[model samples]
Structure formats: C-alpha cells, structure tokens
Target chain A: MELLLVRHALALPPEGEGEEADHLRPLAPRGVRRFRKVVRGLRGLGVKLDLIVTSPKRRALETAEILADLLEGESWVSSHLAAPPSEALLAELPKEGRLAVVGHEPYLSELLVWLLLGDFLGQSALGSLEDRFPLKKGGVAWLEGEPRPGGMVLRAFFPPKVFRI
Target chain B: MRDARAWVEHLRAHLPVALSGKDPEGVHQVRVAGRRLRVYLDLLGWRVLRDDLRRLVQGAGRVRDLEVVLAGPWALPQGFRRFLEGELHLAREALSPLLASPWTAALLGALEVLPPLEEGQALRALGRLEAKAKRRWKALSLNPSPEALHAYRRALRRVRYAKEFLGLPSRREKILQEALGNLQDLEVLLGLLEAFLSQGADREVLALKEALLVEREKNMAEALERLGLA
Candidate 1:
C-alpha cells in the first residue's frame, strides 16, 4: 500500500459562538488558492489516490476535498484522524491501494513517527523526531509498504512550496 | 462578568482530579467549563485562547465519550469492551499531557482576565445566539441526518448557555437539549460499534448494533417532537 500523510491547509481562526464554529473553521482563501497549485504539482508528480480519508474538521475536510477533486479519489471523513494516534487508525486502513490521510498537526507528526518506527516513540524522542521531520501546514509525506507500523519506507516529503514550484 | 471567571475556576478545580483520571466527573466538569468559556469568549468577542480552549475540549471529549460508552448499560462483547478500554486509555494518554502543560495554565490565566462586555453587547450576544439556533434548527428540520441533529444540538446548547449567562428564559432550550443529548449518546455508541465491525464482525457486536440503531430511531422521533420538527 502507498500512504500519503497530508496536513490540513491554513485556516481562519475560530469565530462566533459554538463548537461548530470552531469545527467549521474553513481554509482561508489564500490556502485554497495555494493548495490548488500544490494539488496540480502532485498531479505533475504522478500522484494518484484510490481513496482519501480525512479528519472531520472543516479545514482538513476541505483539504481532502481538493485532493479528491484533482486526483479523482473518493473522500470520506473519519473521526480517528481528528483524535490521537492509535492502533484503531491503523486497523481502519483499507488494505489494498494508495490512500491519502489528511489531518492536523502534532497528531499527524506523532502518527508519522509511529509509522516510521513501528511503534510510538517516547515523548522526548518523539519531540526530537518531530523537529527533525516537521510536516508544515499543507505538506505531505509519501510512504510505500504495507499499512503497518515500521512496514513502510518514506518515498518523498513535499512541503506545499515544493508543489507550488 | 458572565460565568467565564466561574468556569475558569471550575476548570482549575477539576484539573488535578481530571489528570488523576480517578473520577470521570472531573473530566466531565472540565469539558463543561471549557465549553462554557468558549461560548462566553464568542459572545464577548474575545479572540484570545479560543483555539487553545477548543483543543482542550476536543481532547477531553474523546475521553468523555468513551467514558460514557463504558458506563452505559449495554452487553458489549468482551472483545469490544477491551477495544473501548484501549481507546479510552489512548484518549486519556493524549489528553493528560495537554491538561498538565503550562499552556493550559496560560489559557486559563488569559480567560480569567477577559474584559466584561458592555450592557448592550450582552443583548447583542443573546441576539446572535438566537439567530444561530434558529438557523441550525431550520436546517435540521429540513434534513435531520444524525450528523445534522448533532450539530443542531450544539447550537441549541449555545443558546441555552448564552441565555443563562444573560439571565433570560432558557427552559425551552434546556428541554430540547435533553431530548437531543440521548440521541447524541446513541450516535457515539453506534459509531464505535461500526468502527469495531470494520476490524472484523462479531455476531454479538452486530446484534448490539441493531439494538442500538432501533433505540436511536425511537429517540430521534422523540427529539424531533421535542423540537416541534416531528
């Protein structure tokens, strides 16, 4: 399986008076414009996704929608992506093809290390790993292997800038 | 100045107990405090620490949802029970550090010092909340998916809380929220059951899911009636 871990694009700060207002924070107009170019660049690099699983948060959902639009992939929202990294997230993977998972920071970074090392790193070590392999907003890391911890090899890492270029 | 300060104190008092994970009420209270404060911030138009509070609430919510599931009167399969326990543990593991971090204290400090809204601003806040609730209720009445219903419930809650803050009549909002809260609980349970089924289907889990779905439908009807949308 080929997996792409993509962080959500830039979003407006939360506004208004409810939890939905917080959850519904959409991508800023600039984020949409920039990510469109990033998606084009991914297409230019021959990236294709069979499915895109995204966090239910609006920003990440918007990011996945963009990928599905450009890459012709099916998109679904999963709360697991919005929460902590867990075996359940791994278990939820559809075992057969290329997929893109779009979600938030720190969680995505933690997940990246978990996948790379086959297990969660200690908090101290994980911080160092995050520093070493920071996934900026709208960045993506591509890996190839079975969808299990330590089973995949990092194939490429692209910041949105790389795609815009 | 609208219970924001009280909620800050509420959160502070509950922090240690919640971090201990000894009493579920601690986390529950913390979640409540965080939510109340968020609404106050929105109404007062205070921008500081809103995102921080949101992250805290979401983290606590993951733990609280599992706690509710585990405490419910259901005959969960042993495997499913184990899975819930594992999920709850992971959620707590994720939430504990955030609650313990200095940033949380900073968030609390900032919330404590938020300037009070003016007299007219209080009425404006109430007006904004009323508009939001009406809009959400209208949308849900049109298409009451489980997700839409859940979103509607949150809007109702905001109205209820805001009204209370402003010392206005809020009993109607509270009644509606109670009807919706039961439905939301079943929705969370059904979601977990479905996710467990994804791993591999067990006959018992399937049966439990069917039972829950039936209950959810009945509750949905009651909720719609309560909101006069039936």
Candidate 2:
C-alpha cells in the first residue's frame, strides 16, 4: 500500500483576521497556485491515490477537499491526523489501501520521521525547494507500504518551490 | 470432569451476577471476574469456550465505560473528566449501533448466569485451578526481558486470580503483589526516561531525567530485594 503525506497549504495567521481566517480559512492566492502546480506535477508523474484523509482543521480539510476534487475520490476527515500522530492514531489506519493524509506541521514532520525511521527522531529540511526532502507548508511526500507509525519508504518529496515553473 | 454441558451450566449461573449492577466499581468488578473466569477456561485448554467468554467480558467492559459516562461527573477520574465530557458528546452521536451489537447480547446473557454461583458442585474446580496456577507460574518465569514484562505480569495476575477463584491458600500472594508493584514503578520510570530522551538534553528536561533515573534505580534495587534476587 502507498501513503501520501501532504502538509496543508499556507494558512492565514490564527488571530487578527476575517471570519474565514477564524474558521475554515480558504487557501491564500499563492497557496492555490502552488497547490495546482504540485497537483499537476503528481498527475504528470502518474501518481494514483486510493483514499484521501485530512485533519478536521479547516485549512487541512480545504486542502484535502481540493486534492480530492483534483484526484477524483472521496476525502475523509480524521482526528488521527489532527495533532501529533499517536499510537492510537497509527492503530486506526486501514491495513490495505493507498492513503493521502493532508495535515499540519510539526506533527507531520514528527509523523514523517516516525514513518521513515522506526523512532520519532531525525529532521527533514523544509525550507529550500531543491534540497533533499524537507517538510515545508504545501509540501507533499509520497510514501509506500502500510500507513503505519513506522516502516514507510520515502518515494518522493515535492515542495512549493519545485512548482515555481 | 470434562462434561461440556456441566461447564456451560456453571458459566450460565455466574453470568447474571457479573451483569446485574450499574455502579462503575461494581461493573468493573464483574467485568474483571468474567475475564478471570474466561482466562481460567482458556488455561483449561478450551479455545471455543474461552472465545465466547472473552467476547462477553469485552462487552461488559464497554457497557461499564458507557455507564460511567451516563452517571456524569462523579463516575470518571479527575484527570479524565474533561476528556470524558467531550467523549460523551461523541458517544451520544454513536450510541445506537454500540448498544445493539452482538457483544451486548452476549454480555447480558453472561450477567444472567450470576445467581447460580451459590450452588455446590461435585466437580473438582479447585483442583483445576491448582493445575492452572502451576502452568501460569511456569509461563511467567520463562521470559525475563523488559519487552516480556507485560506478559509476565499477566501470568502472575492469572495465578493470583486462580487462587482467589478456588479460595486456595496462597503463600506467595504477598510477594507476588510486591513484585508487581515494583514492576509498575519501574515501568513508570522507564516511561519517564523515554520521554526525557525524546525531549533531548535541555537543562530542565535533564534535571527531571536525572531524578527519574535515580528513582528507577532505587525501585529496581527494592524489587530485586523483594524477589530475593539482590
């Protein structure tokens, strides 16, 4: 099974903003353009997603909804991907399916490290676009095998900078 | 001694007592008793009987948790109160299918069996319990690694429960209790150490780490002494 971990696109700051920013913030203009580019790149690469799962958080849900629209599949909202993925969260993953998890950072990074390595250690660079897989906002990492807390192979990593073309 | 009909009758008699009460502590006790009985049957080498018993016990645990929720603020632990309040909202949203599950019927059926425990039987139930205890102790001593500690604890608990079930004399109960307590202390310390390691070596986290490690060593020494292995 394949698991795709996508960090949600850029979000407006939590406070001092319009109602949309308060709850279910729509993607920023730049975020939309970057997401489109990344989606096109994945399509061009012939990537197929069987399931799309996202955090209940508005930004993540919006991102996953967009991706589900683009990828043509149903998207599920999961509390498991909302925060630092715990053992309980890991235990809930479907045993046999390709899944896409669109969620927030720190947790995403922690999860990526937990998946790529057996333990929650190691840092993936997230800032620069050309560098080895860093988990930046709007970044997506394609992994293969069961969507477990551990034992995931890093198949590909795409950052927003990569979609600048 | 191996009559399936007699065994089923015995099981049915005890089921009701396990299910009649609605109190949180009472429900917990009944569920535990059912689990112990289930484990006893499992150790008797009855897989099919054991599976049925396990399903019943698991259902009781679920119902017990729900009861605690329904009882409101007093039923849960202080630390878990806030969390349970939120969970109760979710529980309300998903109560129907949960109450209607096959497991629920099995639990109610098991509870209906309780009143029969007062009756006397000719079968050598105590002897069966003795045999189960011997087997469990042997299993407990087989693996000593930290990873196997949980299994060891379970085995020890089985032995204790079997003794209680048979009303047997227990010379080792006190030692077993002490050993289990120390083991729990050690496990807590191990958890602290793991968390500290994950947080890295910052001054505050490190001080807490040192304190935990010291406590762990002290507890380990105490446990070894209690077991006569120091």
Candidate 3:
C-alpha cells in the first residue's frame, strides 16, 4: 500500500501558551490561499488515493477537508495520526490502494523517517533541508512499498516551495 | 532527569549548534540531540513539535556524513575538497529557518505539560534499550559483517542516547560509538572513492582509492577488535 505524508498548510501561531490553544488553531487565510497550489501540484501528479486520514487538530482537519475535496474522497479523523504512528496502527489501515495522511510534524517526518530508515541515526548531520525533501506547511511526501520498518521508499517529496499555492 | 523536560532542553540548547552545522561535531550533536528530543516527545505523545527540527536534522545529517568522509586520514584532491566545502556550506544554510520557527516555543510548552516521568519508568525504558543494544552487539561480535557492524553502531548510538536520557553514564557506549563511527567513516570514504573510480578517475585518484581501501581494511579490523570480534 502507498501512503502520502501531507503536512497541514501553514497556520497562525497558537492563541495562547497552552497545548489546547495550539490544537485549536486553524489554517490562516494565507494558508488556505497558498494550499491551492499544493492541490494543483497533486493534481498535476494525477495519483489517486483510496482513502484519506488526518489528525484531529483543526488545521490538519482543514487540510484533510481540502484534500478530500480535491481528491474526490472521504476523510476520516484518526487520533493516531495526531502523534507518532505505530506499525500496528498502519498495518490495520485499509490496504486497497493509496492513502494520504494529513498531519503535523515531527510526527509526520518522524514516521516517514522511521519508515525510510530502520532507526533514526543522522537527521541533523549537516546540510540544507530543501535537498532533504522536508515537509513544511502544505508539503507532501509520497511513499510506497511495504510499511514495515525500512521497507518503504520515498518516490516523491514536494515542499510548499514547489507549489504556487 | 526526572521528566521529559531535560530531553527537551537538551535539544533546545543544541539546536543552534546543529543549525550552525559547519562544525562536524556540532552537526552530529544536533542530530543526536534532536532524535533524543523526538524520543521523549514520542513517549509523551507530542510528535507535532518534531517536524521543524527534523528539517535541520536532515540537512545536518547529510553534511556531517560528508564532513566525516572529508576528515579521513587520507588526503583528497583539491577539487573534491572544494566540492565537499560547498556541500557543507549549502547544508548549513538550509537549517536557518528551523531556528526562527515559533513552533519551537510550542514544543517547550508541550514539554512542560508532559507528565513527570517516574524513576522506575525511566529505568525500565533504559533497560529495554540496553538489552536491545547488547543483543545487537552480540550479533555484530559474531558476524563482523559491515551491515551487521553498522546495525550495531546504530543500536549503540540509540542506547547511548537513551542512557543519557535516563541520566545514566554512557561512557562505554560512547567509546563503542567512536570505534563504530571510525569504521563507518571508512565505509563512507570508500564509498565515495568507489564512486569516483566507477566514473573513471585518473591514475592518481585510482591510487588514492586503493590507499583508502587499504585504510578501510584497517578501520574494519580495529572496529572488529573494539567490538570483541577479533
């Protein structure tokens, strides 16, 4: 099964210093406007997902909504996507076709890295994040092959900079 | 040591050095520090904060690997040296935004709210990690294959980080880590030399490649001895 790790579009800062404040924060107007480009980029790629799951956070929900609408699919809220995902959680996923996960980072990046590299050894060794296929706001990473540890490979990774939206 | 705050602070303090990624140790420290933070954050169920730092980690990781190769005892050509320097410069430049991300503040707040870790829980976690490391070390000691040795190095590195997280001494793990790293460095250098040779390097470069392969054999032998395989 293929999975796409999609970071939510850029959102405004938390309204307060609390975690709840961060959780409740939604996408900014600019974020919504810019994410259209990401949509276009995905459209350009022309790959279809069988399902879409997203974090429960407001911004992630909104991104999921956008993706669901754009990709012509239904979206579900999975609490697991809000944090680091477990292999069991992933194994239980519908294995029919491709799936897209809309969430925040380091959860998304950590999950992707864990999927790519068996153990996290050297993430910050040295270099620009760009060449690294970093998932900024509205960024998307394409992955496939087995979901087991170090069994997956990255096919495509598009940052927000890659899209006009 | 009692809670996740220490790990968070460790990452917060070292992030800038990782961002400044020109220094090899600094880059290596930052990557290790960030993963340590991720480890705790994962335990606390707050991985959202890890994304921004992961970018810095990625950039620093690539450059540090290159730096390690360039730092080898063998002399490299001026052209390759310039290429490596440019690569390092670009890598350091990529991590600049991570320093500015306000989301980092959110991570600190998240750390504060995580339930204070109990001593027992910390010890248990460290024990599990140590056991895994020992198992991996045993395998490497038996096989001494490059792949097995590399896996052992990774396991030891994780144990070292986890040991530090548990506020335990990681001196032995650190020593093993250095020996394993030296062997890994040789592998990385030999990889580049092989790539150059594949591209049809000149006789001088070919000679350098041969010398590096000989050095690789020595590094591997030392690494095996350190791991008690010899």
Candidate 4:
C-alpha cells in the first residue's frame, strides 16, 4: 500500500477573530490553479486513488474535492485530520490499495517524519524524531508499504513550488 | 533550493555512466549509486522498484570488495589474484539482468510525476537533517558504545546523502564516513579471517590476518579521531 500525503494548497488568511475563521477559509484562486497541475502530475504518475480522505478545514476539503473530481471519485471528511495527525488516523486509512490524504501542515510534516522514522503511532519505542520533512502548500509525499511505524518508505516528494503550472 | 525532481534527474542521468564503468572507480561509482538509489526507493516504500537495483549493488559490492583486497599488499599472489579475478567475473555476470531491464527508462518516467519542492525547501530539509546528525553525534560521542558507533554511522550516512543532494559542505562528513566505512569493511574481513584461521592456519593466512588487524586498528582510530571521540 502507498500513502500519498498531501498538504492543502494555498488559502486566504483567516478573516475573523475567532478559531472558526481559520476553519472556514477557502483555497486561494492561485492555489486552485496550481493544484490543478498537481492533479495532472498525479495522473502523470499513473496514480489512481482507492480512497481520498481530507481534513475538515475548508482549504483541505476543497483540495480533497479537487482531487476527487480529477480522479472521478468521492472523498470523506474527517475531523481527525484537522489537527495534528495522530496514529488514530491510521485506523481511518484504507486497508488496501492507494490512499491520498489532504491535510494541513506542521501536522503533515510531523506525521511524515514520524512515519519515516518508524514511529507512526508516536510510540515511545522509537523515541522522539528531532527532524521534520516539511510539506509546503500543495506538497505531496509518497510512501509505499504498511502504515505501521517503520513499515513505510518514502518514494517521491514534492512541495507546492515544485509545480511548473 | 533544489527540487526533488532535479535530484531525481541527476540520478537518472548518471545511472548509465555508473552502470557501464568497468574499472575499479566505475564499479565503485555503480556500487555507490546503486546503494543510494536503493535507499531512496526503500525510504519511499517503493519496494518493487528496488529489487533489481539491490541485486546490482550486491553484485557490484562483491566485486568492489575483492578489488580492494587485490589492490592491497597481496603483492600479486598469482593464485589469489586468479581466484579474485574469477570471483569478479561471476559478480559482474549477476548484474546483466538488471542492465538489460530497461530500468532507466522506467525509473525516469516514474520520477517525472513527482511534485516540485518550494524555494529553499531543500535548505530546510538539509537544516533538519543537520540537526538530526548533530543530535545523533552528540549522543554517540557521550556513549562510546559499539551500538552507538553503529548508530552514528547510520546518521553519518544520512547526513552525507543530504549533503550530497544539496551540494552542501561535507568534507568532514565525507572523510568520517569513508573512514567509518573502511572500519566496517576491515571488521568484516577480520571476522572472516578469524573464522578461516580457526579452521586451520597457514603462514600466508596468519600474515594476512595480522595485516588486516593493523589496518582495522588504523581505520578505527582514524574514524574515531574524525568523529572527535578520540
């Protein structure tokens, strides 16, 4: 199984003075354009997603929706992805085939590094990972193999800037 | 900052050069590139793509090791030279399937689909990598244990790869990794010698064992000094 961890594309800043403002903010116009190319790149790589899961945040939901439309599939929104990614999300992941996850940063980066370091569950066994492989807006990391700690390996990675479109 | 695509392209362009080189240096390049490629693929969970490359590396690695011993003070012992040369031929034969696999074309096509990285994203990745290296080195420096040294070598290799990828300054790391690598080879050779000697001792075998011990000590000392633990 391969996990395609994607960060949401660019989005407008929070307009209000409440936490909910951030939740409601949508993808910027340019983000939509750029992520369109990202979708092409995914298709170019012959990726056919078996499942698409996204955070509840507006930007992430939009990103997930875009990917779903491109793949002609449906997406599931989960609050589990809204905050920092945890091992709990592991259960949310599909048991077979390719899976794409669209979420926010710091969390996505943390999750990527932790998973690569063999501590996907953030268990104490692997101790703490001091480094992070940050994902920029619209970034994606590909990991093939099991989702268990140390079970996966990163195959390909791209941040938003990597898009030529 | 370099994007992952640029790095992948570099690897793709060099694969042919690395594969076709028959000299010691060329074979070594193939071995190194094969190892790096395998590691990168493994990290990304691309296990299927790695099998042929793994075989290529193992084959090249066996030849490289024998070449190293042949280049040493073995002084052209005709029997040993013939023995190693025959082994090198066998090792090279193991690589034919991989060479004929159209691997480069397939790999390049796969890599083209990778997402681009942000400006300075490479820098950030290297920064985090540097920090990880420092943390590991600090821990190993304090411990001075066998397991710690092994762990440190692993981190050093990571730092070395990141440095190579980003074109960062890595003279210290390069030297340290090289020395540590030699130390490992010597350790393995010594173990083999010990096992052979345990079976039965010849004057030539005993002399080679002594030479390997001296080389191992020298390599270990050099590695430790470079690591700042000596």
Candidate 5:
C-alpha cells in the first residue's frame, strides 16, 4: 500500500471566539492559489491517488477537495483525523492502493514519526520529532509498505514550496 | 486571546445582516457570535466587554426566540401568527438601533484590543468553568424542577463554550443542551399562550393551548427520562 500524508493549506486565523470557529475558518486565497499549483505539480510528477481522507475542518476539507479535483480521486471526511493520531486512525484506513490523508499540524508530523519508528522515544520529547520532521502547510510525505507503525518506508517528502510550479 | 480582534470583527460583520432582517440566519449567527465573544471575554476577565456582549446576545436573542417559535411544527392560528409577526417586527426594530448606536460602536472598538491570554491562563479558567458546571449538574435531582433544569442548562452552555475555546469536543454536552433547550422552548410557548389568553380567549386559541399543554407534558417526561429521572 502507498500512503500520502498532507498538511492542510494555509488557513485564515480563526475569527470566531471558540474552537468551533477555528473549524470553520477557510483557506486563504493565496493558499488556494499556491496549493492548486502544488497539486498540479504533483499530478505532473505522475502521482496517482485512489482515495483521500481528511479531517472535517474546513481548511483540510478544502485541501482534500483541491487534491481530489485535480488528482481525480474520491474524498471523504473523517472526524478521526481531527484529533491525535491513534491506532484507530490507522485501522480505519484501507490497506490497499495509493491514498492521501489531509489534516492539521504537529499531529501530521507526529503521525509520520510514529509510522517510521513505533513508540519512538523522541515522540515523547517536546518538539523533537516536529523539529526533525517538520511538515509545513500543504506539504506531502509519501510512504510505502504496511500501514502499521514502524512498517512503512519514507519514499519521498515534498514541502509546499518544492511542489509549487 | 490573539483572536479576540477577529471575534469582534466577526460580530461586526454580522451586525449589518442582522439589522437588514432579510435573513433569519443573520440574527441567529449574531447571537451565536455574541455568546462566543462573551465566553471568551469572560475567560480573559474583560468584564466590560463581556457585559456589553451579553447585551448584544440578549438583543439578538429576542428575535431568535420568536423566529424559532414561529418556525415550530405547530400550525398556529392566523390571528396568533400575525401577533407573533408583530412581536418579531418590534424585536427587529428595537435591535437595529441598539446595534447601530454609538455606545455599541464604542464597545466594538474597545473589543478590538482585548489583551491576549496565555494558554495556561485559559486552561485554568476553563477548569473553573468546568467545576461550576459540575456543581450545577450535581445539584440537580433526577426529577428537577423547571427552574433547576434551566439553571443547569445555562451552566452546561458555559462549559460547552469554554471547552470549544480549547478545541475539545462536546457531543454529550450538545445533546443535553438540545434536550433542555426543547423543554425551555415549550415552556416559553406555554407562557406566551397564557398571556394571549389573558388578553382574549377564543375557541381556536384555547384548543391550541390545550394541545400545546399536552405536548409540553410529553416533552417534560422525555427530558426527565434523559436525566435518568424515574
């Protein structure tokens, strides 16, 4: 199975007072423009996605939509992606074909580290994994192998700037 | 707390739509934004802005309550419907000036610079809010009176909003809020019917009142069941 992890595009800072408002915040216009080019650049590189799963938050959904539109893949929203990644998140994903999961910060980087090194000691160290394996907004990381922790090999990683055509 | 200015801007963005009264959702959104602002301000100990935001929510709330009642499933009599429409109109009219007034403008301006609160401070405030909500929940009996239920509902709303600030899910809190909110709506309807009866009671209105009474009873039973009351 091939896995692609994506951080959502740049989103407007939340305008409303609560977390609910944060969920509703949309991607910035610049984010949409740049991410479109990024998606197209990935498509040009022959990246093929069969399915895309995303956090239900607006920015993640928007990012997945852009990918699905340009990449010609199906997209689905899952509440599971909005929180800290767990075994359930991995279990919920299919073990076949190329798939992309779009979500937010530290969680995405943390998930990457977890997949490469199961129960990694650095995972508990504050900012250690993130500093080493930063996933900037709209960045994509590709991994190939089993879906379980420590079972996948990092094939390639593309920061948003690298993908901008 | 860095988002306080954004929150104020959001409320400001909704004000014109609310004043236009073209969309019922405008008022509803304004009320929601106002309530959220008040909650955040309360956490920051911005009492003046919090109090002003309360007034804003209360103003929007008047229109929102009538809209909800009018949109209910019950087929109200033409006369009663017209009466409710008049009330809604007055509420909207009253809301316009309040939203447009210089004091409100000043309040919005003052709100733009709400001091940022540290994450630790916010979490501590949320803890206090949760404790208050827990106490209110504990005070309620399995079969609580209408007033007790109402108080508990308010407490739950505060906790729910506070949790939202920290990006926590509140599905159970939301469910309870919905159940209690329905009961409260029915209670308000019953009160309005009584007031209408005092003015003049026709057979149609009287019949409607009896039907509503039965519905309220049924809802009350369900709400109690939800609270695990016998």
Candidate 6:
C-alpha cells in the first residue's frame, strides 16, 4: 500500500482575537494558493489515491475534502490523523490501496518519523531550532512501500516554498 | 419436540457434559446444545438469553480468528496487527449504526427457535463432535498436522458461536471471554508451529513446542473453567 502524507495549508495565527475564534481560523490566502499548487504537483506526479483521510480539524478536513473531490475516492474525517494521533490510530490504518492524509504539523512530522523509522522522534529530529517542526503549511511528503508502521520508504518531500518558486 | 421446558432442560444437562468430554463428538454435542438453546430462547422470547448469546458469539468470533492464527500455515506479520486494528476500527464505525436496525433484531430473534430433542438427535450431533475432537487430539498428539490444528480451532469456534447464540447466563460471557483469551495464546503457538514447519524440525522448534505446550495447558485449563467444565 502507498501512503501520501500532506500537511494542511497555513492557518490564521492562533494569537489573533478570542480563543474560540482562533480554533475556527481558516487558512491564509497564500496558504490556499500554495495548496492548489501542491495539489497540481501531486497530479503532475500521477498520485492516484484510493482514499483521502484527513484530521477532523477544519483546515485539514477542508484541504482533504478538496483533494478528495479532485481524486476518485471517498474522503473521511478521522481523529486518527489528527495532531498527536495515538499509537492506536497509527496501528489502525489499512495496508491495502493508496491513501492520503492531510493534517497539521508536529503530528504530521511525528507520523512521518514513525512511519520511516519505527519510533516517534518528537520535534528535535525535524532539523529545526524552534520547538516545532516546520512542515510549512501545504507541505507534502510522498512515501512508498508496505503499509506497516516503519515500513515506509520516503520517495519525496515537497515543501510549500519549493512549490512557491 | 417443541416443548420449551424439555429443550431447555436437555440443553442444560447435555451442554456441560459435551464440553467436558474428551472427543470431538462431545464438542459437537455441546455445540448442538448451544444451538438448540438459542433456538428455544428465541421461540420463548428470552431477551436476556439472546443478548448473552450475542456476546458469546462475539467472543467466539475472536476465538475463531485465534484458532486460524494458531493452526493456519501463515502467520500475520507484526505490521498486520496495525492493519487489522485499523480494519476493525473502520468496521466498528460502519457497523455501529446497523446495530439498531430491525434486521439485527430479527437475526437475534431467530436464535430462540427450539428444535425438538427428538430421540438421540442431540446425542448424535454431540457424538459426532466428540469423535471429531478425539480424532483431532490423537492427530495432534501423534503427528500434529496443520489441518488437524485448523479443525481443532474450528471446533472451538463452533462451541463459542453456539454459546453466543444461546445467550446462556452472565457467567457464560466471562467464561467465553476467558476461553477466547486462551484461543489467542493458541494462535501464537500456531505461529510458532508455522515457523517450525517452514524451518523444519530443529532444536528451536522443539524448544518452542515445549514452551507452547505449557502455555496451552494453562490456557486450556482456564477455558474449561470458564466453560464451567472444571
């Protein structure tokens, strides 16, 4: 089974205005444009997904839903792919068919590490000084190989900046 | 033949004996008793028994899978665990809503029909099961073929499924659940068995068999106790 892990596009800053409103923050305009470009790139690479799964979080779900419409498959909202998706969730993914998951950072990066190397490396392994991994909004990682955890071989890592240029 | 009282009494009396018996005939008998009781429960509108039977069936289903794991030639890779769990999650999600449907109610309702214990019918079935179980035991004791193991597992599953359909008593669920746990351990043994078969008889295989035998005895004891045979 092949898996394509896509990070959701950039969102409005959490610091703006009220707490509840921050949770509802939509993607930034540039983030939207960047996501479209990334989607195009995915299409360019001929990634045909059998299923599109996204975090329940709004931004991630929206991004996945859009992609699901583009791809010939059903889209599901799963907390399993959400930020800090549990080991149980990781254990639950199907082994057959091509799948795509769109969600936020930290979790996405952790998932990547967990898939590539059977262990979750937290934030330190992302090669960034900040407390978080910078999988810029709309970044995409193309992984290939068996669906088993730690069985994935990284094929490509496409950052939003790369798509921007 | 359709008498509910007679059906229940016969099932109650025969089930324990069949379960405790050493041969496949006994196992088959126990299974028959379970099925008869389930049919009777449905006929008599025994809701509680029906529910109990459902739980028993679920537990038995797990045991059945375990049996395949134990007796089958192939062992699911560790990665497959994650895949299975994921599939289970998806299945549960899909099945949740269907649980409330009338079809489910009707299926459960079908468990209450109590067929007549007419002349040795139950006994014949039980006898067949007991004989099968004995044959399996002998095969395992002597040759330990994969096919024998698979048959043994299937017999255990039949027992479990029957219990679930009957919805016997509260303790039945706990006992069945424990038996299911034993089945899982047996599945691990099966995996080892595959390893042994594929790798050929060696010191490691013998060592694994010894360890597995110990575990199997413990699990079997637990299962027998749970089934109220002990």
Please compute DockQ, using alpha carbons, for every candidate against the native two-chain complex.
0.03, 0.01, 0.04, 0.03, 0.01, 0.01
lDDT of 3 by residue, A1-165 (tens): 788889999888888897688776778999988887788778777867677766767788667656764554444445577667577557646755788888887777777777787554555632223236568899999998777767789998888787773
What C-alpha RMSD separates each model from the true structure?
12.1, 21.7, 15.8, 16.6, 20.8, 19.8
Per model, the share of native interface contacts recovered reads: 0.00, 0.00, 0.00, 0.00, 0.00, 0.00
Candidate 1 B-chain TM-score: 0.96
Candidate 4: list runs displaced more than 4 Å.
A1-165, B3-21, B35-56, B73-80, B112-114, B119-124, B135-151, B178-185, B188-202
| Candidate scoring better on TM-score of 1 and 6 | 1
Chain B TM-scores of the candidates: 0.96, 0.49, 0.77, 0.68, 0.90, 0.39
A33-143 per-residue lDDT for model 4 (tens digits)? 999888888787788887777665667866875677444343554556666666777776776788888888777776776667764445553334433476888889999
Give the TM-score between model 5's chain B and the true chain B.
0.90
Q: Summarize candidate 2's per-residue lDDT along A84-147 as a digit string, tens digits.
A: 7778667656766677888777777777767766544333332222233458888888787766
True-vs-predicted CA distance for residue B128, candidate 5, Å: 2.5
lDDT of 6 by residue, A1-165 (tens): 878888888776764576445444567777777788877777777878787766645566446644654566545445566547466565656788888878776778777766776645444554342234356678878788775557889888888777655
Clashes of each: 0, 14, 18, 9, 0, 29
Taking all chains together, each candidate's TM-score versus the true structure is 0.59, 0.39, 0.54, 0.48, 0.55, 0.39
Best by TM-score: 1
Shift in Å, residue A103, candidate 2? 0.4
Stretches of candidate 2 exceeding 4 Å from the true structure: A17-23, A70-72, A120-133, B1-230
Poorly placed runs, candidate 5 (over 4 Å) = A1-165
lDDT by residue (tens digit), candidate 3, B1-230: 64666656676677666666545676677676667765554333333434544654676677777778777676888766666677666666665664544334444443444445466666676677678878888887777788788888877787777667666799998988886786787777767666556755667777777787787778888878766688
Model 6, residue B119: C-alpha shift (Å): 76
Residue-level lDDT of model 2, residues B158-184, one tens digit each, is 566555544555558646655656456
Tens-digit lDDT string for candidate 5 (B141-189):
7446777778888888877877777678878888899878988887777
Candidate achieving the largest DockQ: 3
Lowest lDDT 10-residue stretch of candidate 4 chain A:
A123-132
